[model samples]
Target: MKLLLKNTRTLTENGEFEACDVLIVENMVQTISSFIEIEDVDRIIDCQERLLVPGFIDVHIHLREPGGEHKETIKTGTKAAARGGFTTVCAMPNTNPVPDKLETVQQLLERIKNDALVRVLPYAAITKGLKGEELTNIDQLSKLDIFGFTDDGVGIQAADAMYRAMQLAAQNGKAIVAHCEDNSIVYGGVVHDGAVSKRLDLPGIPSLSESVQIARDVLLAEATGCHYHVCHVSTKESVRVIRDAKKAGIKVTAEVTPHHLLLSEDAIEQDDANFKMNPPLRSKEDQDALLEGLLEGTIDFIATDHAPHSSDEKAQGMLHAPFGIVGLETAFPLLYTYLVKQNKITLKQLVDWLTIKPASIFGLPYGKLAANVVADLTLIDVEREMNIDKHTFYSKGKNTPFHNWNVTGVPVLTICDGEIVYEEDFHV
Candidate 1:
């Protein structure tokens, strides 16, 4: 089938919007020109001047499947990713019967093939059962076209174990994606160690809990020559350590979540569990450093860390509730509103971080837009502001703090491999 996107406004190499039409034949882009005849098209959509770009890519997201289906699944999670303009999301391995061995990874690949609406690159576990004690067969699982290795929900607590994992991953030519947290330093803390935790009468999780682990791992990566990618970096100290590592020429890269960039501890009002997440929102100083790090190229890109939890579980309040909130459905709009509209980052910069930079980091081939490229594209309504209604979300987890917040740059249509994965009736 042929699809023609008409009257599209797309960014050019000069970072200016140019009016054009893109012709997609089956799963590939056939042409992108100022004017294209549309007689042979099976479907046509008038973009009406909305911005068109390569579909977004998220490097870190939790799609609870194989065990935690009550919270989320591959089907619901990928559908939510499509709604948010994401075409590819790397699924973290924190599931029941974790992807620690060949059979588990094979089973996950089969499930993704049957249920996923968007592309999901599954990460194999770094430690078997994610116990942070024994290493999984990294050499064996890496051959299954796995995304990488990670124990996302919990950090690898043992330095010797991490060192061995990094050596094996490096030998297999794969990245060791880390969830940087020292459980010993966490000290049963639920929120950032700052004024907010004190005001809420909650235990504080210190910045060192994240940074100290990162400092150790970067050095390990230096010795092992492994691609060390940090996930959901939330503290100023972590930023400084990463910046120094990058300057020292260590093979280190890092991602910041949308919430860490958009909200600080001050944004937390009361003991709402929706505000609770791992490596909890830090002080305004930490938040400002995160933005600066991104602008200065110290941070590589943004990821959702799109963790979802059941409502009953979240209602347990800040201390007892699970650590996480849904992000895939709200990442782009929220970032566009608070960061781009506020003149902190340009729209083009935001799009690059969400698209090409992430794909480049992970060596994925789907984040470019051109003739002959895969038809993984998305259209966004940059002018029309809409309130986020959790009821309208395709995700089972509506645990976002941005609900009811008015924002622009909402995704209107998303296409993956020439198929319409998500579309709205009309742009408002």
Candidate 2:
């Protein structure tokens, strides 16, 4: 089917918005110009002067399938991604039977082929069963259609194990996406080790717990020449280390979550599990550093880290509740409202962080809105303001801290590969 998106302001290469129309014909962007003669088009969408940009790409998300479908599935998770303006998302390997072997990776591919509404790229495990004891067959897994390797939920604890994994990843020409945390320093903490934890009398997770591991990995990556990507960075020290690594010409990249950028440990309220997450929200100083890193290009991009858990698991409160909160549905709106509207960053920069930057890091072909590129696009109503209600989310997880927050810039239409996967009812 041929689809034409009209009356929209599209983002340009020069970081300016230009009025143009996009034409998609059966999976690729056929044309993008000021005016295209409409003929034989199956559908024409009136965008009403809204913004049309490349679809968002999230490099970190947990589609709890193959084992934790009760929390989320490929179908539901992709639907949530579509509603959030993301056309592609990399699924973490922390599923029931981890995608450590070829068979497990194949299983995930089959499920994504059958169930995903948007594109789903699976990451193979860095360690066997993600136990950090044995390295997986990176050479064999790299041959499969997988997106690098990572043990997302758990950090690789042993330096020798991590060094070996980096060596293997370097040999295979693949990245080792790391969840940097030193277990020895964690000490059963649930929140950031700062004034909030002290005042609340809660176990504190020290900032060094995250930065120490990042510091070690930076050296290993420098030594082995591996493309090391840090996951969900939350500390000021980690940002500084990453900056220095890049200055020293190390092949290192990092991503910051919306929560880490927007909130801090001071936002945590008593007994609210929604505020809990791994590498827990750091102090205000750390948050400021993360923002600066993003603006200065030390942070590569923004990812949702869209983890989901059962309601009962989250209802256990701060002490016992699992770390994570659903992010896919709120990432864009929250960022646009808080960052762009507050003059912290330009709209183009925000869009690039969600689009081209991630695509460049992952070497994917779905982040540009040009001819011959895949028709992965999103139209957002930047003027619309709506309260965030988790009940309205497509994913089963209703564990977000942004509840009742009024935010602008809601996604109204998402088209993936020439198909209209999600469209909001503007009449409502």
Candidate 3:
């Protein structure tokens, strides 16, 4: 089918255009010109001055399948991704059965292919059952279109095991997404070890707990020559360590969640369990440093850790509750409000981080508007505004702290691989 997207602000690698037209023939971009007079177009979406950028690719997300379906599932989670402008998302392997062995990974791939609305790329577990004691069959899984390998929910606590995993990953030409938390230092700590934790009388998770792990992983990556990716990075000290590692020419990349970029420990004063998440919100100093790193290109990507939990579980006290918030449905809105609207970054920069950069990092082929490239695109109404209603979310989990926040620039349509996966009718 032919799809023509006209009168849109198209974001490309070169730059952003005021108004242009993109012609998608079947599943690839046929033409991208200011004026493309064409007939027989199956769909002509009048973007009406909205931004028409490449569909985003999220490097981190938890599609709680194979278990934890009560929290989320591949079908529900990818629906959330479609609404949030993500055409593709890499799923963490920390599932119920845990995608450790080749069979588990294959099963996940088959399920995603059969059920998901958007592209679902599963990351194979680096260790068997993510136990961190034995390595998984990384090479066999890598041959099956697997995204990469990661023990996402838990970092490999043992250095020797981590190094072996890295060596195996390097040999298989796959990346290792590091969770970057040192469990040895983590002892009953809930939030960031800071003034707010002290004031709230909550257990504090120290910065070194993350930095120490990052420091170790950097050296390991340097030694093994593997592509190392830090997931949901939340500390200034960790940023410095990553910056230094990059300068030394190590293949290291890191991502910061919108929560880390937008909110800080001050929200903990709300004393709401919804504010709880792993690698909890940190200090103003750390937040500023993260923004700086993002601007300076030290930070590789902006991903929403996007973990979801049951409302009942979240309603428990912060100490007893699960750590996470649903993000796939709200990431773009939050970033547009906090980053683009505030003039902190250009829409092009945001698109780059969300689209091109992530695709490049994962070695996927969906982030460019070129002939023969897959037609995965997101259309946004820059002026659209709405109060987030958890009841309307496609995600099963409603654990977001931004439930009532008024947000602007919501996605109007999501197109994946020449299919109209999601479309929002303009309210009359």
Model 3 lDDT tens row, 1-428: 89998888876556646678889988888888888888888878877878888898898999999898999989999999999999989899889899888777778888998999998888888888888898988778888878888998787899999999899899989999999888888877889898988888889889888999999999999999999999988989999999999999999999999889998887776568888898989999999999999988789889999898898998887889988898998999989988899999887888888988988877889887666789999999889998999989999999988888998989988989978888988533
What lDDT would candidate 3 get against the real structure? 0.88
Candidate 1: the clashing residue pairs are none
What is the overall TM-score of model 1 with all chains considered together? 0.99
RMSD of 1: 0.9
**Could you give candidate 1's per-residue lDDT for residues 60-120 as a string of tens digits?**
9989998999999999999999999999999999999999999999999999999999999
Q: Model 2, 1-428: lDDT tens per residue?
A: 89988888987778787998888999999899898778799988878889998899999999999899989999999999999999999999999899999999998999999999999989999998899999999999999989899999888899999999999999988999999999999999999988988888999999999999999999999999999999999999999999999999999999999999999988986869999999799999999999999989999999999999999999998899999999998999999999999999989999999999999987888788889899999999999999999999899899999999999999999998888889998745
Q: Give every collision pair in model 2.
A: none
TM-score of each: 0.99, 0.99, 0.97
Which ten contiguous residues of candidate 3 have the minimum total lDDT?
Answer: 10-19
lDDT agreement with native, every candidate = 0.93, 0.93, 0.88
- C-alpha RMSD (angstroms) for model 3: 1.3
lDDT of 1: 0.93
